[model samples]
Target: MNPILQARNDMLGQMEQMRELSAAPIRPAAQIDGAVAEAGVGNAFEDALRAVDAQQHQASAAMAAVDSGQSDDLAGAMIESQKASVSFSALLQVRNKLSSAFDEIMSMPL
Candidate 1:
């Protein structure tokens, strides 16, 4: 099988996983002492960060396996590496957008 095709398939699988994760129902926030508690968005974002970290670790493990001769699938390792890189880049973009929005809100006149 071509490496490019395999990579594309892997990417599509990852996108499907992301879609499932996003489709999960968000738990309602609780009221505490007249203040609303944290919503599910925070948990969702944290879960996404954890998922990206897990992908990075998985990619590293794949590369290590290839290096130690425990695995002969260099192409698979490369695909995992690419997937991790893309996920990290996406997370960074989200963080940047959130930061800019925060800054913009702070600059608004009362």
Candidate 2:
């Protein structure tokens, strides 16, 4: 097996594991006696934002460690940085789509 292909597979598996771990259980609004559910859309969005922020912080810390000569894993630091950058970009894209959708709905003639 090619090393690059093996690495790609490993990364994909890790991502899948992360997705499963982060999967929040959904509860119908009625199940909570009118209390707001933690898995509500707004809460989900907030959670995603928090996760992205944490990723950014982790990447920053990894880079700092490398810079300070405390860690020799430059490649790992770079990968972390890239992951943070990609996640941030994804979050921004989602926000832009949501904003556009809101604007479109507001302009609809009732």
Candidate 3:
């Protein structure tokens, strides 16, 4: 196969791994489980938002590093940044669709 395509595939694989790592369910760490009975919606939403923000920040930083000649692997950085962009865009779409569904639901007759 072509080198660029192979590289892209590798980058995609890495992104998948990172996503899995990030989204792994909280295994109820012993102490926290004992302390809190239920995880609140606000906290979970906040955490998810924070994770996406962090990914965006990291992607930006990586791109900057590549631009400034501070990094060696241009392909890797570009791939990561692209992955971040795709992930954020997907998230935005999902949010929009959810909002639309919610609005539709609210408009339904009782």
Preferred candidate (TM-score higher): 1 or 2 = 2
Residue-level lDDT of model 1, residues 1-110, one tens digit each, is: 77789778887999999999689876544433356755576787898999999999999999999999999899989988999999999999998988899899999999
Return whichever of 1 and 3 wins on lDDT: 1
Tens digits of per-residue lDDT for model 3 on 1-110? 55368877887999999999789776665555667555765576567677788888988898899899998767767777877888788778767877898899999999
Which window of ten consecutive residues has the lowest lDDT sum in model 1?
26-35
Q: Could you report the Cα RMSD, in angstroms, for every candidate shown?
A: 6.0, 5.5, 6.0
In candidate 3, list every pair of residues with a backbone clash. none
Best by lDDT: 1
Ranking by TM-score: 2, 1, 3
Name the lDDT value of residue 50 in candidate 2. 100
> Local error of candidate 2 at 2, Å?
15
Give the deviation of candidate 3 from the true structure as CA RMSD.
Answer: 6.0
Question: Candidate 3: worst 10 consecutive residues by lDDT?
Answer: 29-38
- lDDT (10s digit) by residue, model 2, range 19-103: 9856957666666468755566678789999999999999999999999999887777887899899999999999999899989
Q: Give TM-scores for every candidate, taking all chains together and pairing residue i with residue i.
A: 0.68, 0.70, 0.62
